[model samples]
Target: MGTVLLAAGVLLWSAAHLFKRLQPAKRAELGDTGRLYATVAIFASILLMVLGYRWADPVWLWPRAGWMIHLNNLLVFVAFYMFAVSGLKTSLARRIRHPQLTGFKAWAVAHLLVAGSVQGVILFGGLLAWAVVSVIVINRANRDWTRPPEAAIWREGVALVAAVFLMLVVGIIHGWVGPWPFGGGA
Candidate 1:
């Protein structure tokens, strides 16, 4: 049942996201209202996926090592930093065309490394494929790309600091929900 819910959630979320890419003309016809509806669907599907994942029985594929945990932690921190960079008006943001997507890919890969269960693979692997496809589609859609204006160094520094703080907060939240990111059992 949990696996079924997870698959349904992934399908729903993917369909909601890909609809725009598949039918830009239709999406444009609906405009902001359509975008809002899609957003709602995506969030709802994600909630379902999370709940399903939590309830699912584990079908482990491999033994997780301490090193894998350390690598996952490092990747997660970098992913958060990339996400922060995406939001800030920084030189890094200007240089990196898809910081958010890159961060998401890293996050998915990190989870995939540690989450050896069948459900975990389905969730993270599915998301990873989605992110990759989204990036490809977006790049193809936008043929000509112009560079953004550069931001101040101070602003970039602040964003980096905020990223570090956010990473710590995320680690704490991870511990609260399940496994502690630092290798300590929750």
Candidate 2:
């Protein structure tokens, strides 16, 4: 059930992005509605997965030690920083227009290292695969890899702050919420 929900989330998420590239006209037609549906789909999928997780029994396949979770968290922290930078008009985005995608890959990789359950594979593993494929597809479709614009220093500063905020949030969740997706208690 968790795996199904995870796959559904991935498929919905991928379809949402792929549609924009493959059928821009259709996407424009729906406009905000399209976005709304995509958002709903994503939320629904995640909600279903959460329920499945709570209901199903855990089966650790290749669990990593809790100590190594710190490494995974660090990697995810870097990815979170990249994700923040990618949203801004920083040189990072210009150089890597797909910083979010790359960050997603990094995040997925980090999670994969710590998560070895069937649920983990379906969620993080699927996301990792999607991120890699999406990056390649986006690059091929754009055919333009121009350098990104340099945002104001203040904007960069804001991004840095946001990254730090995200890291704190992740840390809190990992420590207090009991990392079910990835083994907790380090």
Among these predictions, the greatest lDDT belongs to 1
Off by over 4 Å in 2: 151-158, 180-186
Model 1 clash pairs are none
- Those runs of model 1 whose alpha carbons end farther than 4 Å from true positions after fitting are none
RMSD of each: 1.4, 2.9
Give per-residue CA lDDT, model 2, range 1-186, as digits (tens): 655665676677677667777777888899899888877777876676566555555678896877667778777877987888887766566666777877888888888887777777777887788788777777787896777666677866877788889888877786675554334334
Taking all chains together, each candidate's TM-score versus the true structure is: 0.94, 0.82
Error of 1 at 44 (Å): 1.7
lDDT string, candidate 1, 127-173, tens digits: 89888999899899997878778788887788779878988898889
